[model samples]
Target chain A: MSPVVLWVGGLMLAAAAIIIVVRIERGPSMLDRTIALDMLVGVVIAALALWSAAAERTDLVNVLVVLSLVGFVGSVTLARFVAVEPEDEGRILTPEEVRAHDGRMRASLAKESKRRVGGREDAMRRAYPESEDPR
Target chain B: MSVLDWFASICFFLGCALNLIAAIGALRFPDLLSRMHAATKPQVLGLMLVMAGLAASLGSSQLTWKLTIVVLFQFMTAPVSAHMVGRSGYRTGKVREDLLVIDELTEDLDRAKSTPIPPSSS
Candidate 1:
């Protein structure tokens, strides 16, 4: 391959890698991130192939083989364990938003505990209404 | 430049173009399944083309076999990974139902849920 061809191919591959990184950052779900990551691996493989072809290096072929085999494992493992995410949970939270959410959760938990402790008879009646006196 | 070098150069360019296209699709597609369509198909084909170009440029039987192994592994694994991701995406409600025209998997899942399994005979 000529030097010009190599340069152009390298540029294109770089652009693809950049776009894939953006997708990875902006992906709304774990699976989306996984898919972008898988594509990143493909881009890396293509870049390595281009380099090997340009340099006529046979040593790098082993790296290509290993990458191809290992790339799928990350996506497969992620898919196996990925659960349903709430609407806002998929996106990254700001520090303030995280604090607010924690506060809301803690407030609800405190209220529940207070209710249970202060009104044991009411809690029991609610839990076992049928067993309570009808009158 | 000889015919073989020209062939390799063209292959390399086309493969890079395909990678660019796949990246564009992954960025612009509306949903996860569609992005997956972008990620797997063109990406795999582009890798194969790049490998072909590599093999052509090297012009050795030994290196050619190694390149072929890389392509073969990619071919075998891409679909399996895509299927797993798509299935899990669908199960987790990441797929946009309005965009689907067929949806047999959901129908089958519902049927399976409603029907009780028969007892096994000893």
Candidate 2:
């Protein structure tokens, strides 16, 4: 019964993690992706503990302990690398700057997006038979 | 299935569901810091539930004690990890002004802003 519960629980967590991965993939910036990575490690530890208990295996405890330490180290490294200004003293971004920067990136990204879509269509046309509509 | 098995399985399912909710919260939230809060809390609770279910199924004092050790350490350390990540996120310039809550870290940065730590020193 315990093992069954663990298996179900792990599967549920996995599904949730996949959703997080999507966010990571779609993140507009590096920091957004970093948070997702942090969450992923947390999920891993939880799943491990559940499995260890379900299996009646005390031997797996070490894995959780090691991961706990390792996850913190990894987060610290990322946070340090991605440090932001504290939101005070008028130093944080104003609306205009954000708009300007986003506009520039969007312009570039739009061109890329269009090019990729065009390429996909071209590939599709080549893969299909002549009788198939290119549309 | 035995009574013990049935109870454990149900609890395990509940824990898994809670964990998934936490992950969804982490992803669906608009900003990174908010996402961290969502990421940490529910996962710990979910893990606690999972460990308890494991103990029930295994039915060994020694194993239960070990499982408890892992859970205890995880709970204690998760906050530290969050803090480090938040600190680093701030240092590297990832703080989003549009969705921020408290500004305690700003004070921290101000206090330490004057003191320069050479990267190579570490």
Candidate 3:
């Protein structure tokens, strides 16, 4: 009914968005990121609801329902994928095999990290030659 | 807005804030099961409150009915989804038990295998 309400709602939604952003930045795994993003979507839906209330239109509620359904379905699929694995962790690989596999995985991750940093530095250097690389 | 409307909005705000708190708990918790719980319990109820508040404030019979449906469907499905995710994570060795208070699903796995329970086959 007033500008104050609008401002307050917007600020609340912004705060929620900031939480989602922080979660995205610090999430330790893909699933964690996905969950955080799902929370972000929920915040968006809440914001949408408030806007629809402000505008006095009911049509958007249907859109909200549709968006929520789609989000839920997509998230459930991801959760399922995360959930599915054969029920044993005690495979009979030899110690040497395990060590070799671990070594390869670490090497690949390191290479990929380096490649990412290198790409960033190249772009930054092209943008400003005098700037120190942030990576 | 009426005092009733304000009350509804405050309830909704509280629910949403709790849901956000749940998300924070999920993030700060040390294990997957606790996180799954934090994501599920508060959020499902929180969204229900949001739907309820909207329904109350709308003043339209049609809109209210639809909002009821949304709340109902979300209430029904949220737990099913959470359970599936938890079960799948457990099956795949994604479980972290150090933070868990119980393991009701521990026996379920053996029973599931003994009965040859295939995914989505039931």
Q: Give the winner by DockQ: 1 or 3.
A: 1
- Write candidate 3's Cα lDDT for B1-122 as tens digits: 68857855665566557656765676677666666666765456767777766776677888988877766666666666666666666666666767567777776656776885544535
Docking class of 1: medium
- State which candidate has the highest TM-score: 1
lDDT of each: 0.89, 0.71, 0.67
lDDT at residue B100 of model 2 (Cα atoms): 59
Question: What's the TM-score of chain A alone for every prediction?
Answer: 0.70, 0.55, 0.56
Two-way DockQ contest, 1 vs 2, winner: 1
Model 3 chain A lDDT-worst window of ten: A83-92
Kindly report which residue stretches of model 1 are placed more than 4 angstroms away from their true locations once superposed: A95-135, B118-122
Worst-scoring 10-residue span by lDDT in model 1 chain A: A126-135
Could you give candidate 2's per-residue lDDT for residues A1-135 as a string of tens digits? 544555677788889789878877766456567667777776776677676665656677678667765666666666566634344432335799889989999999999999999998889888885847677
Comparing 2 with 3 on TM-score, the higher-scoring candidate is 3
Instruction: Flag regions of model 3 displaced more than 4 Å.
Output: A1-5, A83-135, B102-104, B107-122
Candidate 3 share of real interface contacts: 0.20
What TM-score would candidate 1 get against the native? 0.82
iRMS of each prediction in angstroms?
0.8, 2.5, 2.7
